[model samples]
Target: MSLKASDLKVGDTHSERLVEDLKRTQLVQYAGASGDYNPLHTDELFTVKVAGYPSVFAHGMLTMGMTGRMLTNHVGDGRLTKYGVRFTSQVWPGDTLDSTATVTGLSEVDGVKLVDLDVVTVNQNGVEVLKGYAQARID
Candidate 1:
């Protein structure tokens, strides 16, 4: 059954964690796929030497991808109207990440119902890494 926008309830929480850690190969694959080769994200030596970063970091889009997919996977297709996110912290390989979302508000406009989400991502240490809002149309 398709979950319409109104069907999304507020005060609900869905979360997933990365205790296994993200692999370096996967991070390289993401760099190749997303075409975001910032030295801090692709070149470990550059990240350490030039950028003073400990290691290459995962692209923020990669994490946000999981977030959007989580919503669509739960609600079904053609239901997203607005999706936006912000990277609050850097994600490195071996860092376990947990992503979650909760409904914060709902509205209807021009016959389309819209829902806003309070999305967040945390690492193994419980540090907040990413957080943002997403708006989608109810199917």
Candidate 2:
């Protein structure tokens, strides 16, 4: 049988994470893949001198990806119908980024199960760098 959000309870925990180092090479790779070549992400010298950032920064989407990964890994096969996030802080190349998601709401619509998650991403400094809601359409 396909998984359903109603199968998950309020206290059902689905995901956990460890902070990952945001590598400079991955930043460049993401820039290549996503076509987001803003100097704040790729050009360190430009970032430091012109953009005034301390060093190369990761794209906000890159970190948001971690949030997506958490839900997808745990929820499986289901498609997220709505996903949006707020970028709270910058992620430097060496910054460790951790992400997790928990089921916070569940409902059904026209025989389809739906789930909502309180997703978040934080750094090693124990600061919340991203916060958002993720919704999945389950069978």
Candidate 3:
């Protein structure tokens, strides 16, 4: 459903659990689908021995995509006009992720109602893994 400008205020928020107990298989699948096999994501041995990470970690894009799912769920399909994010931390297998979108601004530009949102995704430990912003058309 579309959001209405009149029904929203700055600081209003929507949140969703993006993933529970993330899996390595899912990371590998994302690697294959996105064609981003960089070994850091799918090769535990290389990630640990070569890259010196604790283990193979989730791709930043995968976490961003999961956060996007939350945004689309809140704002509805095809409503987004702009979206961007920054990766703040690594996400590992078995971690749970929760994403939140907070209303930052609402306005009518050239008769088109729009909403601005500040997006954040955090892990089970409450560590932010992704941060970003999005703009979307609203009713």
Which should have the higher TM-score, number 2 or number 3? 3
Better of 1 and 3 by TM-score: 3
List the candidate 3 regions with Cα displacement exceeding 4 Å: none
Q: Per lDDT, what order, best first?
A: 3, 2, 1
Q: What does the lDDT come to for candidate 3?
A: 0.97
Which residue segments of model 2 deviate by more than 4 Å?
none
Residue lDDT tens for model 2, 17-128: 6446668999899899999999889998999998787898888998887678777776675587888999998888878867777778889888778888888888989788
Give Cα-based local distance difference scores for all models: 0.77, 0.80, 0.97
Q: Which pairs clash in the backbone of model 3?
A: none
User: For model 2, what is the error of residue 8's alpha carbon versus the real structure, in angstroms, after optimal superposition?
Assistant: 1.1
Q: Which candidate, 1 or 2, would have the higher TM-score against the true structure?
A: 2
For candidate 3, lDDT tens digit of each residue in 6-109? 89999999999999999999999999999999999999999999899999999999999999999999999999999999999999999999999999999999
Q: What lDDT does model 2 reach?
A: 0.80
Per-residue lDDT of model 1, residues 4-68, tens digit only = 66456787776766434888787788778888877677788888998888888888888887667
